[model samples]
Target: VKTTVSVIKADIGSFPGHSRTHPKILEVAARRLKEVEGSILIDSYVTHCGDDLELIMTHTKGEDNEEIHKLAWDIFMECAGLAKEMKLYGAGQDLLGDAFSGNVKGMGPGVAEMEFEERGSDPILIFMADKTEPGAWNYFLYKIFADPFSTSGLVIDPSLHDGFTFEVHDVIEKRKILFNTPEESYSLLAYIGAPSRYVIKYVWKRDGTIGASTSTQRLNLMAGRYVGKDDPVMVIRAQSGFPAVGEVIDPFRTPILVAGWMRGSHHGPFMPVGVADANCTAFDGPPRVICLGFQVCNGKLIGPADMFDDPAFNRVRDQCCDLSSVLRAHGPFEPHRLSLEEMEYTTLPGVEKQFKDRWEDLPE
Candidate 1:
């Protein structure tokens, strides 16, 4: 029997502000899953990314199972109804499509799951981020996948010697192009360095061993409007073949900044936070990411280690605190404001709205 773990996420609702999910909405989702658990799933866990709610399930159904996908879809719909009832901010925000058309891939919501011949004591990381888009993972992925500074395994581990291949997507074009790393790596970095656009959807070892994967399809790109920011989710198989858990987490400690805070617009340091920690102080964030380590065998989840809960990492959190205050103090200055390209979805919309009549041709 082959084991598989699926990490599916979608924004159900938020409290008045886009702070966190309403508890009752999560309860509805959990109850809906519980009713069908013994019949459709082996075991499961439910969590959130700021306003988005995620359902991580273990099953034999493999990727995009209709029953499994529908189970998640229905739960989100129920939760969306609760959001509407409560008149929460960004209610039913991630449920973009008119209906769940087979899979949730382009419909709305972010989904990343992989089925593998289970490795004994298989440890994996489940990462969920909010108040930002999928492009936010670009820097973290580059460090873990390509850079020697972050992943020493590129030299230490023979299996990693061949390096990894990257499939960079022109998310706007809905087109994908491939490049092999340690070779064409500089070219890959030139594009992916801009986190608001390109994102790493999946990564594999030189020998075809799965290394990392994330849902790449951004709903805003597909929806053609500010439907909501892409609250992304990722699942990584760690240790041994891939980078160790530290390599996977070290990049976050730098508090590397990205675009997104209030209205999914603004810049702030990326904070390495723990489970159930989703509150933006004043500027809307310190955009946050959480790691929940898990073990699976024969399609069942056995262990989940909260990766950020360590005394050694406390200083890094403090550093992020300082960076957040520094950036917040700037209060919408150049660089502190998002890059021009990213601004297209934010303030530019209002700026463009003002110029709508100016473009009217008189004598061209």
Candidate 2:
């Protein structure tokens, strides 16, 4: 069976400010999404990470299907109206456009879609992040697809030994390039290492089978200003020819630092949290990531086994909290706060202009 999985997410609004989505608004989104099921989707799940609501659906419509995209767009708009009436925080905040332009790509929401022939037991995983940019997934993608330390399969499994290919996007330039791994892994890193500018858009197995994908929309670029952080969603297919489920989730156990915290302006550990615990608080984050694992049979979505809802991840979350305090102590310093260039949504540019004349000329 050919299955197309589309995950679209946006910060329609949050209850009491960037913390969580209200139950009422989720009801609005859930109800609308349910309406399109028999006609537009095979199976659908509505969930959220931090303030962004996610519509995860399985369909045969393929990637970038206008009807599917429009369904997501319509759901968000209706939810936004409910949010507005409820006086929710940042209501309709991520809907940057006055109207949907036949698709939601530039309109505001972050989307990641993939279509593939389902294996006998198609186990898929989604990593949804809150309070971070899309580039935040770069490191995780690299570790799972390229690094032998995290992905033991890379060294042991013959299928993975040939290595995978990376599709990277320069979010600022809105351009992309592909690099085959095992040979070009380091070359791939030289760019994604920055994370803020370059992002891994997709990954493919040696046989050209798609392995993973991340939403590449930099909301700042589309909105021409900072509206909300490009809190991203990612899809990864596991087992068989690809990395095992363990290899994919191993990288997050270390709690790597990523750009996105309070106001999308700081660096913080991307904490792996259970879906129920995914809300932006703490200094507006220690950015949270929730992984939902599913087994697809025919066209049905069988499980969203909250991947991090295990005791195994408790230490990771605790370590992330400890690290967040250390970074937060820096309080506006580099390596903690994002650099000027990375602060694409910040007021730093105008602040730079205001302070420009006060500086004395430096020695040549």
lDDT by residue (tens digit), candidate 1, 1-364: 6556777888767875777887887777777777776679887888776777888888888877888888888888888888988899878887887677778778787888777777666788888887777878888888888898888988898877788877777787677887788998989998998766777877877667677778786776677677657778888887777788788888777778877777666777777777756555455666878888877766666666778766666787788789877877877675777767777766468777888988967796
The C-alpha lDDT values of all candidates are 0.77, 0.88
RMSD of each: 2.5, 1.5
How far out, in Å, is residue 345 in model 2?
Answer: 2.9
Per-candidate count of clashing residue pairs (backbone under 3 Å)? 1, 0
Candidate 2 has a TM-score of 0.96
Against the true structure, what is each candidate's TM-score? 0.92, 0.96
**What alpha-carbon RMSD in Å does predicted model 1 have with respect to the real structure?**
2.5
Judge candidate 2 at residue 347 and give its lDDT.
59
> Candidate 2 lDDT, tens digit per residue, 1-364?
5799999999999987998988887777878878877778888888989899999998998998889888988889889998999899999899988676678888889999889999868799999999998998998999998999889999998878999989999987889999998899789989999888899999998787889989988887787776758899999999988899988998889888988788888889999999889988888887999999999887788988999998999899889989988998898798898887777577567677888889998899
**Model 2 pairs in collision:** none
